[model samples]
Target chain A: MKVTVRYFAQLRDAAGTGSEQVEGDFRTPADLWTHLCARHVFPLGAADLRVSVNARYVPFEAPLGEGDEVAFIPPVSGG
Target chain B: MFVLQASPLPGGADLLPPGDLACGGVVVFEGRVRDHNEGRAVTALEYEAYEALAQAEGERILAEAAQRFGPVRVAAAHRQGLLQLGEAAVVVVAASAHRQEAFAACRWVIDAIKERLPVWKREHYVDGTRAWVACGCHHHGPEAP
Candidate 1:
């Protein structure tokens, strides 16, 4: 299955794009991240990054569905 | 209609002229641009937002505020882009039949706005430095001087 991944803030700058597609048999959010780390030389460290699927924040082990728009929400401090 | 604006504007103080209705109680909350953060002298602040989501989020909060506070007129707005010190970052106004509901609604709207909204703020320091607040990231890039 193909899953879409998104990065935000400094993560996006590091990854060089806001979104991308990855091909994997991953059934969970953690699986997807493992695939990305194994395949690409991610500019931003993927470990310790927050994960979200379909715009809602989620845990790393969150189940993955095909075509889900997962996003890595970089920590932001705003007031 | 609940209003949410991204452009810079005066705080809720400017909302008083919109209506002088017989509302027994009017409550407003204005968030100002402060001058200090994390022991640094903040010279100015800039805000960036996903506009559509921000508006939708604001309206959602307003609707809930009205529902929770009794029948009332509520308006909430947030300033976007570069903002100088003392400028208004956000304004929330609530007018109701009683002061209690009005105050409660105003407070709810502002707190909801801060907690859930997808807005990011960048703080600019007097020494030509800037940092993203709440950005829980290790500083691996060039440090601001």
Candidate 2:
């Protein structure tokens, strides 16, 4: 399946782009992270990053579908 | 329920028309561009967002506040483009029949904005580096070995 991933903050800088499409057979969010970090060097730990599907936040165990919009959000300390 | 806007001039975040005398209490929180972040002098800030998602979230926040405040007036506007330190970027106002409701609803709105909104901001430092604020999701750094 192909999933669109979005990067924010330090993750964006490291990835060099805000979004990308990756080809994988992942069934969960954790599986997707393994697939991504295996290919690219994201600046943070997979556990510390947050994931969202489409526009809503999701858990690591959430299932994926083809063409789903997945976003990797790092912790923000802004006030 | 006004959402993403430009030229929210004067009174910066407090853009609502004069409040009604019947509104016994009005709670407002203006989120300004702070001077420092993680020990760096922030020269300025730029905010960008998916307008469609932002608008939807804004409306959802307002709706939730109204449900709790009983027809109270609510206005939330966030500035786009560039902003300097100490300038207002977000203005949230909640008016209700009583002070308690106004305060609680106002707090809820602001918290929700941070936790749920899709807005993204990049902080420009005086030393010439910028960092985008990674908000609203998990923050991970390498899986445990």
Candidate 3:
């Protein structure tokens, strides 16, 4: 399936862009993260991040569908 | 009102819900960017947000605060992009029929925003180094060596 991945903060800095389209046979967000980490060398692991599918917080195991929008949230520090 | 903007945040008074005569007390909380962190002299900070989710979660926090505290008007605004030292990075305003409720609701909203909002901060130090600010509370697994 194909999905659009969005990155924020440090992840965006590592990825060198805010977002990208990825085509893969990914079954879940964790799988996607594994793939992206290999490609972008993200500084943090999935355990330190949260996954949002279609803008709603979900587990890394959340299933991904075609054309879905996914974002990896790093440890938040907003006040 | 919950929003994330690239421009400078408005003053606390401007964030309050206008013309609520029944409210006897209003609380405004402005979280400013500090000049130093962990003994490092900071020059500026950069904030980024997953805009849609951040706004949605922020609005939910305000709504929850009102429900918990009763009859309170709450609003919040967070700053995106770069901010200098001492700038108001966030402003939360809450008004209620009583002083206690207003104060409690304001505090609740800001805390919830910090815990739940999908926003990130990057600190720029005077030594020409920058690092992302991690709250260190979200990680549930084993710590790295």
Q: Write down the TM-score of every candidate.
A: 0.69, 0.78, 0.90
lDDT by residue for model 1 (B1-113), tens: 44545567655546644474657788877778888977899999877664555666677788888788778778877777888898877777888788988888777776676
1 against 3, candidate with superior DockQ: 3
State how far residue A42 of model 3 sits from its true place (Å): 1.8
Expressed as tens digits, the lDDT of each residue in A1-79 for candidate 2 is 9988887667777889888989888988889999988888977997777677877667989999999988776654322
Q: Per-prediction fnat values?
A: 0.25, 0.16, 0.76
Error in Å for residue B140 of model 3: 17
In candidate 3, clashing pairs total 0
What digit string (tens of lDDT, one per residue) describes model 1 on residues A2-69? 98887655655567776799887898887887777775555455564666676555788888887988
lDDT order, best first, reads 3, 2, 1
Cα error, residue B89 of model 1, in Å, equals 1.3
Task: For residues B1-145, write the lDDT of model 2, one tens digit per residue.
Answer: 6567655434523455655667778888778888886678889988766455567767888888888778687877767667887877777788777888878877777777766666668989988988786553333321110
Evaluated on chain B only, candidate 3 has a TM-score of 0.91
Write down the DockQ of candidate 1: 0.24
Against the native chain B, each candidate's TM-score is 0.83, 0.84, 0.91
* DockQ of all candidate complexes: 0.24, 0.17, 0.56
Screening candidate 3 with a backbone cut-off below 3 angstroms (N, C-alpha, C), the clashing residue pairs are none
Residue B52: error of model 2 in Å?
4.9
Per-residue lDDT value at B7 in model 3? 92
